[model samples]
Target: MATRSNQCDFIGAGGIIRDHNGDWLSGLSMNLGVGQVINDEAKRMLSGLKLASNLNTRKLEGESNLAIVAKLLIEVCPISHPLDNIINSCRHLINGFDEVQIRHIFRECNCIADALAKGSLSRDYGIVSVVETVSFDAPPPHAASAFTDDLCDLARAGSVRTRP
Candidate 1:
């Protein structure tokens, strides 16, 4: 993800797991919407941790990438939308089909997907990029570094908060 162009970078991704109290964060491994595994490299990063104790239940919850991206798409697409074909296709792939509100996307307003695809591909999180179906010639120079300065300043400059 660090190799995408400037427009491709952002903050608040690749999180590490947090303690129950939210002290530390882990982007240790990715959870695809269903029982699928992507980013085996990330799985290796947290190999030493006992993640089985970290599964999501009613009391303790973790999210898949689809959940996170579907939310953002719902919120800031900058227009009213209808449940559409593309969204249905995505929903079919996603595990919790009931959770997502499918909607149409104007190609013009979906810069988020475009940016995410570039970043995902660069990081070789191909499950995300391929599922998203965005293609590019490869990111330009300074794409990753330029975004590091602004987006890396997470959540009020070193102040982390508990989930409310």
Candidate 2:
């Protein structure tokens, strides 16, 4: 999930479902028209989290680039932050899995999802304040062929691995 800092604030969230062997199964990308960067980031997390939860796959490992969001998901209580509502929603999604693990990765390793998100930002704003969801068989326009290799490298990278 990511936020596009432009004249019109945009939030982009993306998820790629893969098999146990790490083969890609499907992908989803959502673009939301919201100006707040934090809110957009939270929304992106929530959207991706919900998508994974709905898959009915019991054991799952989720990754995010935002440490704050991962921390909030682990400590669901406190609720002191302004984004408590969004954080709580993420907590609810985490409950769906029999065993769920969340970790934070470097921004560089999150290229595929980031590209999908940026693509959402560049898309035509139909309603100005609408959320658009797109499922792709191939990389979106914003993502290039090189991103595929980066995605593969990210899957194999062992740095900054966490179970937060």
Candidate 3:
């Protein structure tokens, strides 16, 4: 997510990694100082890809709320485009995976990640702090409710089995 104020532009990126069963494996949020929306989105993709690589994930199916970004990943990006470098990097990382696909989803379906990105904006981390990324083994407090809602929705859709 990207927000701009009179003082500065705040960019935050967050993503959740889930197994095929839809069980969360890990989550990440980053406070990326200042950047444009497109840049931030590309950075977010790069960060998520790096995290997945670090986790040694061989297959990946990434979902982005931004259709343009997802399209860029699957299509060739012009060298003159502002996000060319980042887009290329994302493609390079994707090649390392045994299988990879990036698709677009509606914002409503991406609540947890949106919450985490918003949470990054409210965090007390100093603007100039070197430590910007936060990793969570479980859902963070700010995203807990969204996480629960997601599970409930999945259960209702029969995508996942609810606990008895």
Candidate 4:
């Protein structure tokens, strides 16, 4: 998730769904009008989790640049916060999976999603498909590079923190 201003309001949210083999499945980008960054981050995470579940993903791993959002999703963040309702809903979605992992990633490593979010900022308040290639050949010129970058990131060697 990203914000258009220094106050961290007016969010731009985006996420990508990929297979274990690093093949792209689907992706989403949305412009979430005006809200706090953390709130928008949580909302985007819930949407991403729902998308994964819809794709029948059982053992899922998700990463976000916002450590607070990651913490909230895993119940490490304070429970009495204002986003408790949304956080609880996220927990429910997580429980639906056989195994789920949500990790905090550095902003530099989350470039593809960031680019997608920026691309979505100019659109309406809904999903914008940045990349949805289903073929074995190759994606379009603009998306091929982003796809490659995300594939490398997915294949990168890093230990993920377990859910709380």
Candidate 5:
């Protein structure tokens, strides 16, 4: 769950909550922690353009299986969530895909995603693709680490999992 200050009003307010449940590659995670500094500096000057405007084509090189699964879930799924910030982000990320959408999952049933995240923390992976002139790739391994098990217990024991 998010902080109380941030309300869950998005239509797909729920998140998978992938909080480091696997045997992450500690070295990779540590390296990424440092690399993000450079990436942030490089990307710092690149935003504020219209939607789908990216300058780096290399960004579209690595697409991970987790993102593909998320994309799949968005298909043929029904959501009754609110219009919160998280959902807004998902919408932006999934823009132009008419068949895909965000949905609320109880988190207990999202353990697989959580495991993916933990695994990613140890290594960076992605498949890049292009839309229009913009280029983007699947979220990096470190970025994927942010995902969680949406309190659904799809695997594992309960709704809440401790980050490892």
Candidate 6:
């Protein structure tokens, strides 16, 4: 997910990887500096795909709150579009996976990622590089509540099994 600060043009991108059981595998927050929202979305997707590749993940499912980015991943991006290069790079990284799927999701359902992106804007991370993007093996303190809420929601929906 990408979030832009209303006070300035600063943008932040954040994402989380989860296991099939709804357990967090990893999380990322990057200070993308000033950029267009669409550009930040494409950059975030590229960053996520790269991270997943590093983890040697054979299969991946990615979700973005921006429908345009999700659609561009599944479809051809206009060559003249500003995000064409970044979107194509994302696609290239995705092909390295044995299987991959990208889809759009509602912002409300993506609270953890949203929180992470918002948090990034409040800090002075200063132009995060792809390899240097702030990564959390577990959700950070700021995202704890959203992560917990997600787990509870998943358990209640029977998407994640609960232990006796």
lDDT of 1 at 30: 23
Give RMSD (Å) of candidate 3 vs. truth: 4.9
lDDT of each: 0.28, 0.63, 0.72, 0.65, 0.25, 0.76
**Model 2, residue 150: C-alpha shift (Å):** 3.9
Candidate 6 has an lDDT of 0.76
> Scored by Cα lDDT, where does model 2 land?
0.63
Q: Per-residue alpha-carbon lDDT of model 5 for 36-63, expressed as tens digits? A: 2222111111111112122211111111
Name the candidate that leads on TM-score.
Answer: 6
Model 3: per-residue Cα lDDT over 1-164, one tens digit each: 33333444677777877767667777888776666777777777787888888878888888777789889999999999888999999999999988887887776667777777777876654556563778888888898888888877742111111111
| Residue 40's lDDT in candidate 2 | 68
**Model 6 poorest 10 in a row by lDDT:** 155-164
Please name the candidate that would achieve the greatest lDDT relative to the true structure. 6
Question: In candidate 3, which residue pairs clash?
Answer: none
Scored by Cα lDDT, where does model 1 land?
Answer: 0.28
Locate the minimum summed-lDDT window of 10 residues in model 5: 9-18
Superior by lDDT: candidate 3 or candidate 5: 3
List, residue by residue over 98-144, the lDDT tens digit for candidate 1: 23222332323223222333344344334553322222222223233
Candidate achieving higher TM-score, 4 or 6:
6
Q: Compared to the true structure, candidate 5 yields what TM-score?
A: 0.25
Tell me the tens digit of each residue's lDDT in model 2 across 9-103.
65666656554555454566776766665676677667766665565566777767777766777765575888889888887877877777777
Consecutive 10-residue window with the lowest summed lDDT within model 2: 155-164
Q: What lDDT does candidate 2 reach at residue 103? A: 74
Per-residue accuracy of model 6 over 95-127 as CA lDDT, tens digit each:
888777788887667788878888888767554
